[model samples]
Target: MNRKTFLKTSALASAGILSRPFITYANASKYRVALIGCGWWGTNILREAVASGVVEVVALCDVHEAQIDTCAKELNTWCTDKPKKFKDFRDCIKNAKPDLVINATPDHWHALIAIHALNNGCHVFLEKPIAHTLKEGTAIQKAARANNRICIVDFHRRYSPHNVSGMEFLKSGKVGRIQEVRAFVNYSGNGGKQKPSEPKPADMDWDMYCGPAKLIDYHSGIHPRAWRRQREFANGTLGDWAPHWFDQILWWTEEKAPKKIFSTSTKKIHDNIQTVPENQLVTYEFEDFICFWEHSINNTRPVQQGENVGAYFHGTEGTFHMGWHGGWTFYPHGKNATTIHEDPQLDLPDGQNIKLVWADFLNSIKTGELPHADIEHGRQATNMSLLGMLSNDLGRSIIWDHEKDMVTGDAEANKLLTRDYRGEWVYPS
Candidate 1:
C-alpha cells in the first residue's frame, strides 16, 4: 500500500471511534455479527458462531428467500433482539454496523466481502480457499495486515486437537524421516450439473448471485445449490474440502508453499471455464517429501492400498493414515503391527481446540496478536489448493516460484493466479 493510502486509511479508522452509539455501537452490544450467504456450509458457521456466545447475530443476508428464512429463524431464536435482515451485504454492513462479518459466501466473493468488512472496522471470519486464486489471496493477506483486524479463516481441522496431536507426532519424527505424504478426498457429490428445478423465486436477484462472474441464466436449482459445478460460482471439491486435508499436510510438514505441482483430472465438461477437475491427482513437490493428492467427486473412499482419501506420512519408520476425522493410527516403520497406536476411545478435548481458536481471535483483537490460521496462513494454504487447481487445468506438472508466486512453465496458468476486480470493489488498503 502507498503511504498516502496508509495515512488515509489510518485516519479513517481513528475517526470511526466517534460514531459509536449506545445501541448499535461496538461497546454496548457484544460483537454484533452479520452473516452473508446462508448455504450448506454457512449453516454450520452460523450455528457454531452463534453458539460460541462470544458474539451476537445482528444482521443476516442471503440471496434466496427460503435459505434466508431458514437461517434467520434459527438465528432469531438465538438472538435477544431481532437481527436485522438484508438481501444485499452492502446495505447490511452500512445499516447494522456489525463488529464482525462472517462470510460463508462462494469463492468468488471471499476477497471482496472480507476486505470490505475489514475496511469498515469489523473483524472478519472468512471461509477457506481465501479467494478463488493466489493473487486475491495475497491481496487479502495485505488487507488483514493493513486493517489490523482479527481475520480468521475457517480451516476448522487446524483447531481439532486430534489433528494437532498428529502434527506433533510428525514433528517428533515418530514416523522417522518423512519420504512421502499422500492425501485423498474422494466424494460422490459436488460435481457435474444439477437437474433443473422449478423457476427461482421472484424475490431473488440472480444477477447479484452471479457477482463478479460473467452473467448467465437464473436456475433456482443452480443459483445456490449446484453452483459448485460452475467455475464462476465455486472451485469444485478441491476448494470445497482440500483445506481440511491440506491443514494436516501443511501443519505436519510445517511448510508454507511447495516448490512445484503438476496435476491431471477427469475429462472436463467445458475446457474454457476454469472448472476444478472432478477426479484430479496432483503431485506436489516439497523440500523434504513429495505430496500426492487424490481428489475425486466419485469414489467414497481410496482406490489404492496406500491411498484411502486420508493423510499418509510414509517415512523410514512407518506409515500413518489420518482422514478428515481425528481418528489417526500409526504402525511401526518397517515392522508389522509390533508398534501401533490407535486409540479409538481417545477424546482429547477437541472442543477446547475450537474454544482456543475463537478465544485466540478475541484475544488478538484485544492485544494486536495474529490468530491461528490468520490471513497469511490462509494464503499459504489457499496457495497450495490453487496450485492443485492449476495443475489440474494444465494436465501437466508445473514448477513454481514461491517468492514471486507463479508457475514457471505456463503463462496461461499464471493468468488465474490473480484477477481484475469487476467493478469498484478494491482490495482493502
Candidate 2:
C-alpha cells in the first residue's frame, strides 16, 4: 500500500475513544499491565514483570485457556490480586483497559495485538523480530507514534550488562573503530520437520492462535515450539535469532539500516522440512563497515569464544567477542584474547538480564525517555532480517534506500517487503 493509503487505513481503524484518549499515568506509582501469550518465554517475562513490582498484571489473554489458567495460578503465588483472564485479546483490551500490554505472541500475531494495544491507549512491550514482515513492523511503529504510546521491542540483549559495558568500553576508544562484524547461530537440529496434522485441542482456540496467518490443521511440530520452521508463520532462524545479534550490532556500531544486503540459503540437510533454511549466509554493507551473518542447522562448529552462537566485532585496534549467553572478550590486534567480563563472574544468575530489560521499559514510561530497544530500533533490526531473507530469495544483492524504505531499483525485491495478512486481518492499508 502507498503511504497515503496506509495512513488513512490506520487512522480509520484507530477511531474511537480508546484511540482519542491516551492512557495517563497520573502520578500513580503502579500501572496496570496485561500479559498476552502464556507460552514458555511469555511466562518468563511475566514473572520478571511481576517480580519487579513495577506493574500489576491485571489481565491475561491467550488463545489457549489451559495455558492461561496454569500461568494465572502461578501468578497468584507472586501477586496477591487475581488477574482477569480472556481467550480473546480484543476482550482483554476492551474490558481490562490496561495501562500496559506485554505481547509475547508468535511473530504473525505481534503487529495485530500491538497495534490494537496502542490504539487502546496502552504502552506495549513486544517480543523481538518485531513482526512477521517489514510492513507490519512499520505499521506497529506507526500506531505507536500516532497514539503517542511507548512501544518497546524487547530485543533483550541490548540491556545485557556485558553489551552495555562493551559499548562503554568501545566508546572509550579501546577497540578503535569497528570495521567488520560477524554473527553466528549454529545448532544441531535440521530446523524441525513437520509433524502430522491433527485436530485442535478442545481447550485451544486454534483459529485465534492462527490469527493473521493461514489457518492450518493443528500439528505437534507447530505448537509448543517448532513454529519457526513455517515460512508463513515465521522467518526461521533469521527472524527467531537474528534480531538479538543484529540489534546488538546496530547498537554497537551506531548504525541504522544497511546500505546493501545479499544472502544465500539452503535446505540441504532436510528436504522434508516445509520451510526455513538449514544453512544460510548473509552479508550486509554499510557506509563505513560491513556485517556478516551465518546460521547452520547441521553444523556444530564452536565459535571463537568456544560457543556455537555469538557475535564478533573486528576493529582496528582490537577485536571484541560477545557471547549470546552474556560475556565479552577483547582480542588485541597483536596480543592474545582476554576475557574482559564473564557473565558468570558478575554472579547475577541466569534470568536477570531479561528483568533488566523489563525494568528499563517501565522506567522509560515514567521518565518519558526512549527505551534502548525502542520501536524504530526494533524496526531497523527486523528490517535487516527481512531484507536479508529477500536477498536470499532473490539470489542477489539488494541495494537499500533507508530514506525511502525500499529496495532501490529492485521492484521484485521490494514486492517481498510486505506480506498479505490472512483471514479477517487486513494490512492497515
Candidate 3:
C-alpha cells in the first residue's frame, strides 16, 4: 500500500483518543533527529537516517570524544550547520531540542537513555537487547506509556523486507502448525581473538561507556569493540543475537512471550561469562512448540543461518527454510528436492523502514501512533532475552508467569528481573 493508504489504515486502526484530527495534522515535515552513543551500530543508524534526506540532524551526543569527533566529521560532510554535540546525553537533548533520539548506546545503557529521551518528549529508536535488566525494560515501557511517546527498538532483522516475507510464508498456513523451532548462532573464535592489552585512547570515555555496569579496568579483551562478550555491560551470546531470532520467530509464530525457559551455559574455558561463552544453549517453551537455540563464540561460517541469519518454521505440512534477504525454499514430505537456488529474488526496493521507522515516530510524536517496535514490543523482546540469560545463570528450566512477569517457584531466578540503578536515576511513575 502507498503512504496515504497506510496512514489511513493506521489511523483507522488507531483508537478514539489517538484519532483526533489534530493528531493527523501533527506529522509535519522537517523532523529533528539526534543520535546518542556514536558507536559502530549507532554510526550505521546515523548514516542510514542521513541517507534518507527526509530527516535533519539537529543534535548528536556521545560520551567518547573520538566517536563524537568522527560523527561530527561525517555530519559536517553533508549538513552545513554542524550538529550540536555533547558528552552527556542529558544536556544534549535538553539544549539542542531534537524531536527524535536514536539510541545506539551499549545494551546496558539502552533503557536509561531511551527512557530519558521519551520522557523528554523525544521519540526513541533503541538498539536491541532493549535492556540489561528486566526491570529496566519494564520501566522503559512504563515511561513510554506515561510520556506519550514513540519508541522503536533497533532490531535490524525485523526491519528487512525478508522478515515481512518470512512472516507471510509462515502465517499463510501453507506450512501448517509449527512443531519445533531450532536455531544456531555459531561464530567460530579460533577462539575469537583475546582482547588486546592496549592503552586507553585519550578521547574514549570508558566510564560513560560502562554506565550502569560495574566499573572495571580498561582491558583489551573487554573494551570498545569486544564488550559484547562481557556479562554485565552486554547481554551475553543469547541476548546478543536472540533479538534477531525473537524478532523473527514471535512475529512468524504469531506469539508473544515464551511460557517457560531453561538454559545450560558457561564461558569458554579461558573466556569469562563476563567475557565470552564457550558454548550456551537456551530452550524456550511456548504453548504449542519449543524453541531450542545454540550460541557458539568460536565458530564463524556463512549462512549456516542462511541469508545473513534466518530461521526455519517446521510445520505439519512441510519444512520451509526462509532466507528473506537471500532466498527461500520448501522441502516436501516424501519427495526429492530440487537443487536449491542460492540466489532467490531478493532484489527489493531500497528498504524504506529506516525512513518509515523514523516517519512512524515523527508521526507518533504528533499523533501518538506507536511505531512497529514500540515500548511494549521492546519490553517483550527484552523480557525474552533476559529470560534466556537467567536460564543460563540458573542452569535449568523455569516457569514464567506472563501475568505476574516473574518466574514461578524460582525465587533465585526471579531476582534477575531488576537491579539497583544509579543513585541519581529516577524511574517513571
Worst lDDT run of 10 residues, candidate 2, spans 16-25
Residue by residue across 1-429, what tens digits does model 2's lDDT show?
A: 233432343233223112112223223428888999988778878776776555767898998888898888777666565679999999999999899999998888898899999999999999988988888888898999999888988776665556666666766788888889998888877545545677777999998888878877787677768887788788989889898889888877766889989999874657444577878899999988999999887877854355677788888887777775557777777656554655522213344356656766776787676776799999999999998888988889999998888889988887888777777888753
Score each candidate by Cα lDDT: 0.69, 0.78, 0.68
Q: List model 1 lDDT by residue over 1-429, tens digit each.
A: 233432343334223322212222223446788888887667656655554455777788887777788887666555454678788899999999999888988888888888888888888888887888678887777777788788988766665545555666778877888879888776666433445435667878776776776666665445566666567766777777777677778767667778889777777544222345777777889888898888766667744543345688888888887744335677674435565543322213332233334544565676676766687778887787788887776667778888887778678888767656555555332
Model 1 TM-score is: 0.83
Give the candidate number with the greatest TM-score. 2
lDDT of 2 at 17: 18
Q: After superposition on all CA atoms, what RMSD does each candidate show versus the true structure?
A: 8.2, 8.6, 6.3
Residue 60 alpha-carbon offset, candidate 2, angstroms: 1.1
Cα shift from native, residue 355, model 1 (Å): 4.9
Candidate 3 residue lDDT tens string, 191-263 = 3444545676787777776666776677756655767777768776777877767767776765788998888
TM-score of 2: 0.88
Residues forming the 10-long window of minimal summed lDDT in candidate 1: 17-26
Q: What would you estimate as the lDDT of candidate 2?
A: 0.78
Clashing pairs in 2: none
